[model samples]
Target chain A: MAASALSPIRIDDPADPRIAGFVSIKERDLTGRQGRFIAEGTVVLRMLAAAHHAGRGLAAEAILLLESRVAGVEAIVREFPAEVPVYVAAAPVFDAIAGFNMHRGVLALGRRDGVSGRDALIASLPASSLVLAACGISNHDNMGSLFRNAAAFGVDAVLMDETSCDPMYRKAIRVSVGSVLTVPFAREGSAASLIERLQHEGFAIWGLSPAGETDIGGIPPAARTALLVGTEGEGLPPAILESVRTARIRQRPGLDSLNVSMAAGIALHQVALINDRI
Target chain B: MAASALSPIRIDDPADPRIAGFVSIKERDLTGRQGRFIAEGTVVLRMLAAAHHAGRGLAAEAILLLESRVAGVEAIVREFPAEVPVYVAAAPVFDAIAGFNMHRGVLALGRRDGVSGRDALIASLPASSLVLAACGISNHDNMGSLFRNAAAFGVDAVLMDETSCDPMYRKAIRVSVGSVLTVPFAREGSAASLIERLQHEGFAIWGLSPAGETDIGGIPPAARTALLVGTEGEGLPPAILESVRTARIRQRPGLDSLNVSMAAGIALHQVALINDRI
Candidate 1:
């Protein structure tokens, strides 16, 4: 069988300019990469390749792989346009370039510049939609899990407030298991304004909090529904919780609240089941 | 106000024999800890203190605290018996002893000799019970989350197979928000035997998997119900999945499965709500 139409470019130097975008990934994770982000592992690479092939607003800028892995992902690599370079390196070079041990040995540069705008995404939602909105979720793992849950439950779109970290962050993307690439999400504005816009669009928004008055399961399914989650310790701001209808997952009387992402999954599952969207 | 009835001892040396149990915590995590385990942060320390006071079969052997955090956790420290030594150190000494940055400034060595055996714990469950069983759940974070979810949903007891990782692992306890200390759990036997024993106890078991035949929400609530989840990618071993009545959280057709912990939370919440436990 043929290896494929795509050519593999060998990279021996950790300092190779061709693989610059993939360098010092851990350090680059903290500093913004303009419009580019890193996608790692074969699973995520497959997702990015599929998204690019399907023209789903994300494009693969390039790919870096351990030479041994090139054969395994040839089918996925072939999905990318010919212009997108695929670089392979030895273990030492890969480790040195990434500034850490990357056992997975697969990385890709991606562009989110084509992501839809918040208003545009909101306007594009169907009349009957199930959506997820995150507020003040700064943890990358939580952010990724939120997207993964949203995708698993077939949420129509995700809206993030300004205080929330980028789901495109490397760890978040890895946590989301590449749902970040396929899930349509827009990050802009403050939590309050985002809530206001969703309300204006005639969506019933339910902020998830321990103090929530209504049981999440008891919430009546609506034509358009959105589940809002906040940061871990301090839940949704009191005002925001008050502004929207609130739902709680009942728990034992004296325990710390469930992890933010865990709560999101439960709430999303409940809403999706009631709405017949799952 | 008086700081506490118990006195604090100061230790300047990182290698102090008295603090051996708390040394190189990261490395110790890999080595078998015998009956000893490390609990960090004020939250877990408080949980340990309470567990010890309640005669829950767990005890705080000793505590190591940064000098600065003593005031904040004075009440918690006081919860421990007067005989338990409390050691205080400066920041550098504390970090050196821990073999890492000890930002939380609190640590406790605990013993879990009192945890009930699987059969004993199972026999102790009330006539009506909601329990969570884990199969091949090796990741500490997921294990922690499972216990957290179990506690939140008012599960009676958690049963883990021999193949599962210890819930007492330092990171798991922290990730569980100290649920591991409070929740009653027994790790023993193989997955098949655990299921068989639960079935013999008249508990209707639901193994959570993507291939599960019934929607999780559709499972009829039973007087004794147990929810079982496996590792992330492999899910429940095929033999185990086939051996038990299976249920799934309905998700999008083609996406990857939800993180095992997230899936557990969703299933637990569903069963808890149905059983009127939460």
Candidate 2:
């Protein structure tokens, strides 16, 4: 059986050709990673395995782990198909290959495949749904937090503009707690174009901003709604805010605004509650 | 003329005696800070100056700057009394002293003074007020986010248990965007004792947990309301949850809980809105 065929291979050398994809992970995170990404730690590894088993268009190509963690992760590793290789290395070799001290000591190489186009993802959602659309979300932490919040609130899908950072980035996936692996998402086109598509599908769009005209609480629940958020300092551009219904979360005067991800989480909770999704 | 007396001092050595407080900042952040904290970046530096001028019990003992940034922050440095020395160093010396590449080029030594006692802080609130109470928030980033949410929602004061991390930690202060300076807060004592004092003040306490009996939205606005939140994974202890009125933010079934800071922000916004504070 495929399950019985699983045996972790030992890696003594950091420069082994078989583990090339796992070398200098920190550097790979910055330079273009093509369609491949890294999933770190046990929690994310389990999520990757689950996604793979469910045929969610995310595949685990291979895994590299510290020798000590091999026994602990044996069950999770068994979930993957036999074709997937699991490499175990001592701390010295693992750290050398990663080019940094990897405290978690678990890593998996994943490839993005069969992801839906923006149009198809939007069209696939039910008539009544909650969506989070992000624009110019350049920071990976905020992007990850956004995905985590979306999963917690049962968001049908997350849409990002071309300027948004890739959700598949290692830090983003880790921050999302692997939500990026399970949640349906698409990133492409301009913010305005994405908004136009949602509007055509009879979705009520609410752009979050400090200067929004209507208070966020005052936004009535609708059949289908999209909570739109933007980058930290330069919020949704003037044109995008003007294109959609904008709402503000009232706050004390003179203080800097809430972190963008926190603001979005608050807004999503309210919308999800009123829409009865949670 | 204190303003004219404020002259920038140039330091050629990383081991300069005058700037002793700013040396090995990263190391100091983990070890004891002796009531002293570092404020970084232009935004936080401005806030520190404002706190000093307002006599809010936070004083800037010294200022350190990269030689290149001295010109830009001269105005802010002038806000401090002449007794507060402003030291300028080249990138190499500054980086060596900081034990890391100091990207923002601004740092200030601040001392906390006249911070309110738990009883004094609770008793000082008006008859009708909103407050945020945190229990076991050990993460610096989460601690900072809690304070930011408190300030945004106009919470009267923030109360933390002994187990919670210090809000004055350098990273905490930076993450809070200086909210830790302006907000009225007290962190000491056990979580149970702190909550008892709030109850004595006739404050309605709502402990947030996923298993909470009441939906957060269902919480009625009261004259004196305090929203209590716990750490990320092992949420509020059962004893605490059983003691207070419990509320939960309804969410999807299978996903991990929201980030502690994000969850607190959502609940705070709800309470603040119902109380007409926002």
Candidate 3:
């Protein structure tokens, strides 16, 4: 293996042009060019590297480590199949540029792919697949957790509706433990239209609504299914509810509803169980 | 009606002793004392007021709000039944005292309840009640989310084993949306002892193990069941697994495991479904 050479670049000034990608952490939408998606801590960095190696297109363009964090970064870099650029800077300078307290002492910048459209996602999935359709879920963490659960429960793809937050958002990626990078996902149109299309394509669209008439267990183990989840305060839109075959995870009378992500996790697991029966 | 008996006192001093409870943000041991729990934001304050109205014994000992945030605080106090003390301080002083940015600009110190031991929790529950037993879950947010799910799914009580984090931590309370305060919970002995006790009390102990032989959906609905959840990285301990009948949430073959909180949510919802069938 020719040592795919990557030199360690030293950054002495916070305003150094090479370190511009790290500034202004608060402004996630900088220049609208899919700004650097940051992954902190060794575990997350290793996951990013692994995804990159597995042809998931998660290659980190640059690795930033504080002077004291060089050892940890070196250990992580040893596992990477490709030699990526490493940047070393003073702790204070790094903190100033990063705009936050650098607890993990290591951060990586990676190019983000454009959000996949619904057609692209549908084309990539098997005929009979378990899918999680997230609609109107605005909380980035919740969105990330839903994707993470989808990955864990073997959902073939995660389809997001128009109102759903971007899965590539920094917080979403961090919360998903980098599963967002590995999992196939795309943004569909409106929830109602998507449900209609899925139903037409022989996908049993089970809206995970609290007010649904059918119990979640009574879904009759379909060959192909999609679990649709809504936001926290408001559940599925009335239009979507009316169009899809509704199912609910039964709960006690007094409790209002489960947290959106929690509900998604339960529904995804149940769907996986039903799929296994087939 | 009574001219709002609780008058707002303005304080500009950061060293004011009246706000000592709000000063130590990072010190957990200090917050364990009575009159130490801090509730931030208007939503939580509203929930606290509602809990107080419901005679749940959550009374704000003192309220602190930034001068600019006076209107929101006043609105909350209007709904508060009791004559709770309200204090108005400069935003900088409030932030200095709270040791962080106060986004909601409002904070309250509530009386902390003595967390019941395992014996007390078991004694209080009905013979056929469902309980959630969490073990070795150290993440505060995850524990909080579990409690929220348990409450939503109508679990009788949430019991934390020896290795679990404290449910009353500030982050846990915030993440739980004050559900931790509403839900019945107790920190108890080892998972083994609790499993034995529940079994002796005619409860079916269902340990959630990823590697278990039985699928969660396969378990026949039981009159009284206790769902056991362990930490995310490590599932149930071997001793706990041996003590209880085990069930696994079926997942994709290659995925490692679901987040413990997500798993707890799914399990609670499934148990609730089982209960509904009976």
Local accuracy of candidate 3 as per-residue lDDT tens digits, A94-200: 88878878436777877755545687667667877888887888888898898888778777888888888777766777778777877888775887777767776
Residue pairs clashing, model 3 = none
What's each prediction's TM-score?
0.97, 0.94, 0.82
Give the top-scoring candidate (DockQ): 1
Q: Tell me the tens digit of each residue's lDDT in model 2 across A1-278.
A: 33224567889999999999999988889986878999998889999999988886889999998888887788888888889999989999999998887548889999998878999999999988899999999999999999999999989999999999999999999999999998999999999999999999999999999999988778898989999999887888998999999998888888888888998898888788878888
Clashes of 1: 0
List DockQ, one per candidate, in order: 0.87, 0.82, 0.54
By TM-score, highest first, what's the ranking? Answer: 1, 2, 3
TM-score of chain B of each: 0.97, 0.95, 0.89
lDDT of 2 by residue, B1-278 (tens): 34234567888888889999999998889996888999998889999999998886799999998987877777888778889988888899899888887448999999997877889989999999998998999899999899888889898899999899999999999998998988889999999998899999999999999999988888998999999999778889999998899999889997777888998899988888888897
Name the docking class for model 3: medium
Q: After superposing candidate 2, which stretches have Cα over 4 Å from the reference? A: A1-6, B1-6
Cα RMSD of predicted structure 2: 2.6
TM-score of 1: 0.97
| Cα distance off (Å), candidate 3, residue A2 | 16
Question: Superposing every Cα of model 1 onto the true structure, what RMSD results?
Answer: 1.5
